[model samples]
Target: MYLQTTIIAIIMVATFALASWKLKSPEISMVITAIVGALVGGFGFPSRLLVEGMFTYFDVGMIFLTASIFINIYSETGAMNALVRWIVKQFYDRKWLMLVLLGILMIIPGALTGAGSVSIFVVGGLVASVMSYMGFSKRRVAAFIYLFAMLAAVSPPINLWAMLMAAQANMPYVGFNVVLLVPIVIIALFTIVYTGTSKTPERKSKEHILSELPLPPEGMNWFKIITPFAVLLVLILLSKFAAFSIPVLGLPLTFVICAFASAMMDRKRWDVRKWFDVMVKTMDQVFPLLATVISVGALVNIMTATGVRGLLAITFITLPMVFIYITALLFAPFAQGALSYGSAIILGTPIIFLFNSVGLNVTVTAAALSLLFPLGDCLPPSRIVGRLTVETVGYEGSYMSFLKAIAIPWLFMGAIGLLMLIFPNQLDFLVVY
Candidate 1:
């Protein structure tokens, strides 16, 4: 049984690593994954293989695929341009203001949409040109954008994790977010102060900075730019209020709104056929990530199915909570965030249930996980934050310096996390969903 589960874990993780770290094709990875699953079942090499059933594998893929399609559609449409222009123009004159504002903007939409990579890429690319002229360090920008995805993790309206988990618990997401906003804000501000106000030498520019980064072609307007996203926001908020209920269409609904908005925004620049073509370009860049997410889900599902995840559960029992939370805190951005939120829930929930379940204190762990996961999302090679920030901002990918800028800021957050540990009940102030 152990052997069979291990095989699935190996196959699943291998596919994910290949797709992400190595930048391999998703089709190839999926094929490889299915083959491995086939061998595991057909040859009966691992007797326990069947235990990791189809439902687990299929559901993970569906959720991930559905989510990606939504993001993909948005990317293809070019609606993200308005957001870029709006943000750059607002922040160009004030570097510190831009830094804080960028983090805030990233947090709001990202949290609402649960679109981490997509949102970060959009913001990063748009702001790159502006940042280059302004002279912020690469590391600072990288860390800044890295947190860009994270701020969403805790923010309201979107609260993807909360929505996913809340459905199971039958709780109100808005209520949860409202209650925890203070702590989340504290964590977020800590991240901002840590990552935004870096120690790296500030590379202020001598040449007069431009009044604004290049706007999208003449036709784009703020209304056209934000209308789709606004619809999405309204729908989610209405759903929360019982005024309306949104379908569980994952991300497609939002993407559709954005896609049409994209067309509306770029009518002169691109026709329908050309617009659809942009999605293909988007897929070339994004599909692999979806594949990676699905593969990781498969691996984790298999592990849980085959009992390897149970082993990990057993391992968690031996470690002190401090070590667990702190370690997770220090390095989650490299894990690509958002996803780690799930892992922490799966891993931490059990311990909490084991220790004493059924309360908001579980939220602290969730809070701690929330804090850590974004850090993982921003780390390098994966280049979660820096790479996209540099690319989005239209630079030569020199955002490494921005990462250095946040070193001090990270410590400050770390300090806060450490302080939180002293008060056992304070964790409840963090969000669980």
Candidate 2:
């Protein structure tokens, strides 16, 4: 049975590669892989499994979709523009402080939404403009956008990779706030500093840069800009702190409420027609990621039903500790490169179970593993985040050059993830759940 399952798995991999190569769509590639796996496993077109699998992460997809809508609405209010302009006007001359502030700014969208693409979409272009004003090259701007956005996706509140693995392993997705927050902040800041200092280009005058930034629409103010996020924070806190007293709105509804609140703040810009347009635009932005999520669920369902998941888990559990470490470092990004979020279920859950069997703190291990997955967002086949970052930053450089630009921070982030995995117990104190 093990041998048969392994063969099926290999065939699935080959099919995924071929589909990805031919279709160039990770979502479709994964669906094709799932169908082929089912056929090889003798399931012969299991319609129920296919449908059930596709909906496995339906809640997650909703969170992403609603969050995208929320962000689009927020951006439509000119909040994002006002915020970026405020940052530049306030600290553009204080280079280090400005870099740090910008890093934190980039982190917020993805941290809230658990989709790095949101960060790239909502704030990336604005931040890229700021980076260019500092005389950084387009390649550097792209690297900065990708790296911070990646870390943002790894941050607390909505780390999708960690959340998915935890759900798969029957672990609650709590206690990750501190576990994810500390390391992500440190790494994000370091990435910002490292990338910001590379060129040290002559700083453009504040007046010139400010003039170049988009003028925030009339009626924009700090109160209008800050109110929506404040509402989001309050809702999230209420859900966590007063769970029993309040109805459970979940992240999706919370985002929906916040979207309405944000739209209310800028009524002049947000009529019903405007809201519909933003919804359509957001759906267009989110379709690829939503499709990837659905396809990953289907593929994982097929793997589990066919014993392929069990075979992989047993194989991982039996590997030497050192080899497991190597796999965490090496296979993670490659898998993610090919599979996108599918890597979380395909590899991350098994590794978490393996670590749990060995007395490692599963929360810490899961959190650590989340750090490694986004690095693959820029790699081949999918290159989802990388492609978005390049386009958002208008990077016309060679793809290889862009990859080379981010090499240092990428390795640095990977090293941090490996350390967290190796010393999960030591990091256990960070878990507050």
Candidate 3:
């Protein structure tokens, strides 16, 4: 049984590594790997497993779809642009303040959408440009954008990986948020200090900062700029604190409502056809992620059905708790390719169970695991976020330079993960009941 399970694990890892290294689409790679696993394990019909996997994350897919549309509509309304311009104006001539505000701006979209790419493509790209014009190196700009976007993806109200890890551990999603706060704050401060203080080439003209700013539309009501985000925040708070129950739909409904509200606030009228068009475009951006999620489900089903997951869990149980914790911290990042959540579902779930079995605090372990996974977001070979950062910053194939820029932030977070592992009680105060 161990031999068979090990072989299955090897095949799965090889498939993921090949996809990451070769730049093959993760969705296709995962689906094909699932088929191969089923065949090797003699799991009967692969199609059944595939459907089961896809169905497992149907609601998550809906969230991604609606959230994508929300971001698209919100961006189209120029709210983000107005917000950026306003912040830059407020912090004008204050370099540190501007950098700090830029970091916060980069974080907002990802925090709302729970996708690093959304944050990167939506606002990180613009921030990169503005910072470049402000005289920061391409590498520094890429690092700043990558760090904050990653921070946003892992933080607060909509972190998909935290939600997944919590669910797998049978913990409430709300409960998990508090435990994450300390690390989030640490990483954020470190990022701001590190990137904000780095010396870069000085801009020839300070006036160009304002000149390069994205102007809000004519007759635009600046007050209305806050509406979409405000509404979304209120809904999220009400959902969490007020026990507000919107029957048959929850957060996804909030996303849809916010998207509509944002569209309505736009200076340009968006008819139903236009709304449909935006949604289609949003889905085009969202489908690859959705496919990857579903494929991960299929892979999980195969692992569980084949008894491989159990065998792996038992194998981990044999290790020293310290070794288990360290291995998970070091190895989980590489296990994550373009699919952070998928990696969580695969590598994270089993190890989480093992941690629980060995008497480690499941909540702390889960949170630490969440921290480690984002390292994979920019790790070499598959560096999806790093590549996107380079392109957005116009580093144009400077992947290595981008990696170098992000190295410190990555190591800092890794050290935090290690601390969490070593001093789990230090975070006990933040534990949710």
lDDT of 1 by residue, 112-180 (tens): 445466566545554444554555555555555555565564555454444434432333433456434
What TM-score should be assigned to candidate 2? 0.98
Model 2 weakest lDDT span, ten residues long? 194-203
Assess each prediction's global lDDT (C-alpha) against the native: 0.51, 0.89, 0.75
Compared with the true structure, what per-residue lDDT tens digits does model 3 show for residues 395-431?
Answer: 8645666677788988898788777766665566677
Q: Which ten residues in a row have the lowest lDDT in candidate 3?
A: 240-249
lDDT score for candidate 3 against the true structure: 0.75
Order candidates by lDDT, high to low. Answer: 2, 3, 1
Please name the candidate that would achieve the greatest TM-score relative to the true structure: 2
Error of 3 at 192 (Å): 1.6
The total of clashing pairs for model 3 equals 0
- TM of each candidate vs. truth: 0.69, 0.98, 0.92
lDDT of 2 by residue, 119-206 (tens): 9888888888888889888866777899899988998889999999999999999899998888887788778777767775566898
